[model samples]
Target: MDANQQVPSEAALLGLLQQFTLETERYVEAISNRHHLHRTDLNALAAMVAAAREGKTMTPGALRAALNLSSPATTALVDRLDRAGHLERRRSEKDRRQVHLEMTDSARATGSELFSPLAGAIAPVIDALSPEELHIVMTFMQGVIEATMTARKDAALAEPMRPLPGT
Candidate 1:
């Protein structure tokens, strides 16, 4: 290719893939918001519900790690969610020092109802893909997502300080 000519490569393909993924997420959020939940709150509640469903419990420390948040940030998130009646912290039966995070009944029901249609719409598409194709696509998508996440972390760390509007 000449200097001005472009050659399509894996990077170009991944860019298109990422765009589609983000668009799908935006669409899902728009649809879910019709049911009265903001996308971020829904995501947090869903995460807590999934962990409970999978027989895993999250402590404040685990949540901090999972969200890549500091202890104070995680505590604030937990407090807000708790006050919203979406989740509760309980003393762990097996470990006294650890508090297990659990989704409240209302949150679980709301999440399930909000997501059921979205899940139904995607199920057929997923089912149509062959097992091998699904695995390959999932693996590639995971890799792309991980790379994007790491890049975001690095960018945040390297961000320049901004001056106040009038200062």
Candidate 2:
């Protein structure tokens, strides 16, 4: 093996990882669309529902940060979900200016019903994994997530496009 040569193991692993991600995304998108929700809205709804389930509330600012959206965009998303009766925003009692988001009862039920089977479907595969294999898979997944996050941050920081000064 030459010092300059890359490891075949790494290349094979990366290819499988990429394929898994692409297929998973397509599957989620199909599920979301079938349920009459955009992928982003479904993601937001799931986040709000999970937070509520944990007895925690999320503010618009937090939601915006999590979803990587501007305040206005967050507000619009909240407005749409609220209008659809999927979520509700209430002014914080301590700080009336701050708005907290929560999923409606119907939304909670719907989300649970939709996700339960999906969880069940993956349970068998999870059960089949040995503890050590599960740990390795999770560690590799975390590395991939970190790498993707870093790439996104780096892209965000790239120099802005500008027309030639002479033109």
Model number with the top TM-score = 2
Candidate 2, which ten residues in sequence have the lowest lDDT sum?
45-54
Question: Tens digit of lDDT per residue, candidate 1, span 1-167?
Answer: 78997799989997898798898798768866676555656656666766777888878787777667778877888887888788889998887888988888977787677768778988999999999999998998799789989998898799688998998
Clashing pairs in 1: none
lDDT leader: 2
Clashing pairs in 2: none
Model 1 residue runs over 4 Å out of place are: 1-12, 49-55, 68-73, 159-167
Count steric clashes of candidate 2: 0
| Whole-model lDDT per candidate | 0.79, 0.84
- How many backbone clashes does every candidate have? 0, 0
Q: Write the per-residue lDDT of candidate 2 for residues 1-167, one digit (tens) a residue.
A: 99999778977987988898898888788777778877778879877766767888888888888788988988888888888798878899999998888788978877777778778988999999999999998998899899999998998899978989997
